[model samples]
Target: MREAFHEQLDGVFDDLAGICRSVETAVRLATQALLSGDAAIAEQVISADADIDKAKEKIEDTCFQLLSLQQPVAGDLRVVVSALRMVTELERMGDLSVHVAKIARLRVPDIAVPEEVRPTLARMGEVAEDMVCRVEQIITTKDVEAAIELGRADEIMDGLRRQSFAELFADEWAHGVEAAVDIALLGRYYERIADHAVSVANRVVYVVTGDFPVDV
Candidate 1:
């Protein structure tokens, strides 16, 4: 019975990891669509959201099955519960990507993102992607220390968000209000993506160390 329970738990982890990868891909594609003014790619990201939703549902169902059948105890219970919470965060991350894609579609002929902000957005995307990847590593390795470090990386994203906002709100770009709003929204989305990644890392920390990260 114990071995069977462990097998089910492993399956749950695999599902969660798959969801995370899908979300990460969506985010990357959305960022590219924004930068390139690719209406088609933006539409693709918007349409692909349903796929992420379905993956989340499957993960949730698997988690429920694990809990119902295994009745996990102590650390095992933590792993099961954390898987559910992690998938919730991953789903939100996927939604944020869709939000960015919507903005890309709205901009249409006149790209919503200004050239000045492109570099910052690219950097933000890189950091957000790295966070998602690292969270997956933490989940697979059960590395509490690595999870904590991933959480700390959120600070870099926060700083970038603030800088981006400052530039957007500055007097020089006053004429581009609509574009500025889009850029600001995009920055917030990327920052929140990192935030959610940190949340997943926290869950991994709890699952492995049996304690929630101190600063979550």
Candidate 2:
């Protein structure tokens, strides 16, 4: 009976890991679609969102089943309960990626980013993507140290977000309001990806230590 329960727990872990990887890919591919104005890629990201949702649902259902059947205690309970919450954040991250891709598709053949802001957007995407990857590692390895450090990592994304906003709101800004809105929304999407990644790390800390990090 104990072995069967552990197997079920292991299945939940595997499913959660798959979610982390999928959202990471979504963010990266959305960035590509944004930069290149590739409708095809953007469409692909939009469609791939279904898979992320399905993964989250599977984890949530498994968590509910475990909580009901196995009645996990202490660390096991933490793992099951935290997973139910973490998948919400992960799903939102996936949605943010879809938001980014929708902008690319909205503009169709035209690149969503203005030339002056391309480098900043690129940096935002890279940092946000890396944050997700790091969060995944923290979740799998239960690295409390990395989870604590995750907040510091978010600073890079915040900085880039500020830079993007500055360009859009600058007096010399030539892009019209329509373009300005796109830049603003796109920057926010990247920033939010990092934010969710940090949230994931926070939940990971809770799972491992039974306490949320004060800073992360």
Candidate 3:
């Protein structure tokens, strides 16, 4: 019975990892489409988001089934709880990517995004992507160190979000309002994505160490 339980737990972990990977791909593709002003790519990202949502539902169902069938204790309980939380975070990340794609499609005529802000936006996306990747690693390895590193990446996303706001409001106040709003929302979405990734990392820490990491 123990052996069968372990096998089922492994299956749950695999489903969670698969969901995370789908979210990471969706975000990366959405960022690329937005940067390159590719409407077709944006449409594809939007379409792919549905798959992510379905994946989330499947993962959540699996977690619940595990909880019902196997009376997990200590670390095992943490794994099941974390799987549920991770699915929620991954789903939110997918929705954010879809939001970015929507913006990209709306701003199709103006292909050239502001040169100054482009770098910052790119960096934000990179950090978010890195955080997602780290969460995947943390889940697989149960590494508290890597989970802590996710916090650092999240700080970078926060800094970029503030920087984007400052630049948007500094000059170009009249003509740049709409563009600024779009950029601001994009930055916010990226920041939130990082936050959710960090949450997943924290869950991993809990699973490994059996204690919640202090949120700093």
TM agreement with the true structure for every prediction? 0.95, 0.95, 0.93
Better of 1 and 2 by lDDT: 2
After superposition, which runs of candidate 2 have C-alpha atoms over 4 Å from their true positions?
A: none
The sequence of per-residue lDDT tens digits that candidate 2 reaches over residues 1-216 is 678888998787777778999999999999999999999999999999999999888888888989898898988888888888889999999999999999999997788888999999999888988899998888778899998898997998888888888898889999799989998888888888888888889888887778899854
Better of 1 and 3 by TM-score: 1
**Global lDDT of model 3:** 0.82
Candidate 1: where are CA atoms >4 Å away? none
Any residue pairs clashing in model 3, and if so which? none
Worst lDDT run of 10 residues, candidate 1, spans 169-178
| lDDT of all predictions | 0.86, 0.88, 0.82
Question: Clashing residue pairs in candidate 1, if any?
Answer: none
Query: lDDT by residue for model 3 over 1-216, one digit each (tens)?
Result: 668777887787777788788888888888888898899988998999888888888878877877888777877777788778878888888899899888988888564357778898999888888788778877778789989888888888989988888888886644466788789889888988998888888877877777778863
Sorted on lDDT, best first, the list reads: 2, 1, 3
Model 1, C-alpha of 1: deviation from truth (Å): 0.9
Candidate closest to the true structure, highest lDDT: 2
